[model samples]
Target: MSVTMSPGRYRGLRNVSLPAADTFGIVAFDQRGSYRKMMGAQASYAQLCQVKSEIISALSQSASAVLTDPIYGMDAAMRMSPRAGLLLALEKSGYSGDSSYRKTELIPSWTAQTICQVGADAVKFMVYYHPESGVLAEELEALIKQVVARCHACDLPVFLEPMSYSLDAAVPKASAEFAAARPAIVIETARRLSRIGADVLKLEAPHDIAHNQDEAAWQASCEQVSAASAVPWVLLSAGVDFAQFERQLRVACAAGASGFLAGRAIWKEAATMSSAARANFMAEVAARRLDALLEIAARDARPWSDFYTLPQFDATWYEAYALC
Candidate 1:
């Protein structure tokens, strides 16, 4: 594919967000509801921030960027000084509606200007989606377009994450029927959302994890997702185990994924350990996972530059650039 080098502001910020040149090894610490569910009664504000800060501190140095929530990790990320660039989550903690038709909402009183002013390199908004949701799908797509316009206006890249859920109440995600159809759902979701103009995509595994164990199927599904996405794309861990996620990452990278913006598979186990052990795990085990992921990504993953090359310009180029 040919690359387009556009205005330098957006290009530069996008490059900063991907520390590994054009590849992504973003560490997603922005999770809320699931983070609480895992910790149960212990999911206090203090505990959440602590976990986010600690593990992020341990892992951020290796990641391309850190995806943080406004309420918790953003402050710590700005203060503690991680080596990675920051990508703030614009969506609220969880989605509206049930398993049938989920809708995502932005965090109250937050805007693209807030993200740019806070020195974030990118904005991430995740919507639980299925193109078949009709008006609900339109609503989510509208929100994404609004976010993309705003972020691009601010010269910040937006990483759109479109999560697929079973719309049929009868055929839940755990059912065999749902698993069989998940690949198509994810690919179509990518195809639909790609047209919204987000700079990067952080997507879930296209193939079903529990029901499908075939490596060939995994590779084919990932290739389809890559082909469907017009922009660059990365893999998300999606609460899978480390070993399984590693396998998925390998398949995805080889099939044309830029890299990963993973969370649970890399650090969830640390949350369940004791405080001291948590610190140890973050420094040792989780840190090693980051290394492993980075190595895989650097080796087999496609670069975001594959989609758009960074702008080349002279020092005086800024004089002509608009900053509204």
Candidate 2:
């Protein structure tokens, strides 16, 4: 619960407009060609730079927020420009002889350097709690303090993501799972995070979204998360696709998600990075959706040209009138 203060001057970031309250900002990681390396192809530094350039160029002058994690090392991504916001993974390394978990030396040093190298105001650090590490919440809390202290010494703001550990029964794979668990466990996760110093509470949402059946269940979980932390809550998309991505965004925004720590959907398409033709194609698609929504939100008096058709407005009528 103790918040650390920095020794250096606090550089307040300029006021950047938040994405529409109903709109969950999209941030694409995987600039390093996804977390796990491919079989044959190795993602080179040059390729990562190319991806970074494309991301910056695509951002244009729009005030959208972005979060990019490093590929192989923190240096590559840290050295590059952060057009949106920058984030680096500080995954916990399992404990040694003692029951305490250790922060990978690279994490504390690189994270500190990242904030010092890149201005702290524009940078944020993301740490994942690995349950297999035998590091309990108390130990994890201390690690967070140490990490934050490093950031604070250099005057940086930190955003934290707290997750539950689970394994797929059939596959025998360990992963961060929060979707299907008893309410108490989820609440405990939130409470633990709150006891530590978490600026933004990023948690997993309920997997299934039924029409009316699971509303109370979902709401109960959400309330627990909110009650456990004073910080605003955002959801990790859990790797949803484009259509599902959009739907999930709408649902999250409606469910009071402050923002999203999303990957895949924004970066999944090869076209989004590879070729100019592909890049433009993806950009135009995004622009169409974003433009339409922004136009509606901005409420521009002038009649804007409808680049993409609004077929889904009314399903039956939309289906009947194919091209309006």
- Highest TM-score: which candidate? 1
Per-residue lDDT for 86 in model 1?
A: 82
lDDT of 2 by residue, 119-197 (tens): 4343344443444445454576787777666654555445566544442343211222333443455466666665555
Residue 68 lDDT, candidate 2, scale 0-100: 53
Distance (Å) between predicted and true CA of 153, model 1? 0.8
> Given candidate 2, what's the lDDT at residue 70?
46
lDDT of 1 by residue, 1-324 (tens): 645545633554454445545788888889877777887885788887877787777777778778888887865687544567788899998878887979788888999889888778778888898988899989888888888888777777788898888888999887899899999998998898988878778898988788999999999999999999998899999889999999999999999999999988899888767789998888878888888998898889998877886577897988866543
Query: What lDDT does model 2 reach?
Result: 0.45
Task: Note the Cα lDDT for every prediction shown.
Answer: 0.82, 0.45
TM-score of each: 0.93, 0.64
What are the per-model C-alpha RMSD values against the true structure? 2.0, 14.2
Candidate 2, residue 33: how far the Cα is off, in Å:
7.4
